[model samples]
Target: MKIVVVSDTHIPKRAQRLPSRLLHELRSADQIIHAGDWQSLEVYEQLKQYAPVNGVFGNTDNEDIIRVFPDKKIVNVNGFKIGIIHGHGKKMTTVKRAFTAFNQPIDCIVFGHSHIPYLKYKNKTLMFNPGSATDKRKAPFYSFGILTMSDELHAQHIFFKSK
Candidate 1:
């Protein structure tokens, strides 16, 4: 499966729309995952044009978004259990919160909040943060994530200097 992962769009607050590069990437995605901070339903509607999307809602999301999605969720794809969260709160770091959000076994965790691209292994689970496609914050590049599944799972960040 070709999964495109993104988060913290912040919509018109951060940018008027999804980055053009991100839209281009979405064209080839088999599935899309948004970690959170969508801020508007328009983002979801936009992503649905490419592929089925599953995600969590962040602290910045409005009632409409929260009503449609949870604060955390487990998405099953090709038998791989992936945990998704916004990774926001008052305790610990964003990664730490995501690492412990789920009480069950998960092959990977996709989360965002700090707008920093991160990919690493914690314990036995893969921790992935696609950063901010619209708001890179202090990161050098705007970024997203891609997950390829076959005999094994592979994940990589798609970074670009321009939007």
Candidate 2:
């Protein structure tokens, strides 16, 4: 299965739309996961065009988003257990979040909030962050991620140069 992971879009505050590169990546993905801080329903709607999307509300999101999205969730894909969260607590880093989720029977943890794209392996679980799709503060950057699942699951972060 191919899963696209993204987060912290912040939308109008960062860019006018999702980068074309991200859209292209999503088009080929089997599923989509948005970590949070979407900032608008339009973002969610836009993502839906690429693939089926599941997401949670970030600290910056409004009540409507909170009501619509769960704070955390678990998805079973092709026999692999995947956990998703926005990572807003004190231990917000990927490693920390992965460790916290280690208690669960999950094979991977996907999260975002700091707007930095990263992939790490903790013990047996893969941890991933898709960065900010709106290029919030770091460089003229935006990105999305792809999780490749087979016998061994792997994560690849794809960056988008802001246009």
Error of 1 at 138 (Å): 1.3
Q: Give, for candidate 1, the lowest lDDT window spanning 10 residues.
A: 146-155
Q: Please give, for residues 73-131, the per-residue lDDT of candidate 2 as tens digits.
A: 88888899888888887755555864585467778888887777778777777788888
Alpha-carbon local distance difference test for all models: 0.93, 0.81
TM-score of each: 0.98, 0.90
Best by TM-score: 1
Q: What lDDT tens digits, residue by residue, belong to model 1 across residues 4-83?
A: 99999999898998888999999999999999999999999999999999999999999999999999999889989999
- What's model 2's lDDT at 98? 43
The candidate that wins on lDDT is 1
**TM-score for model 1?**
0.98
**lDDT of model 2 at residue 3?**
88
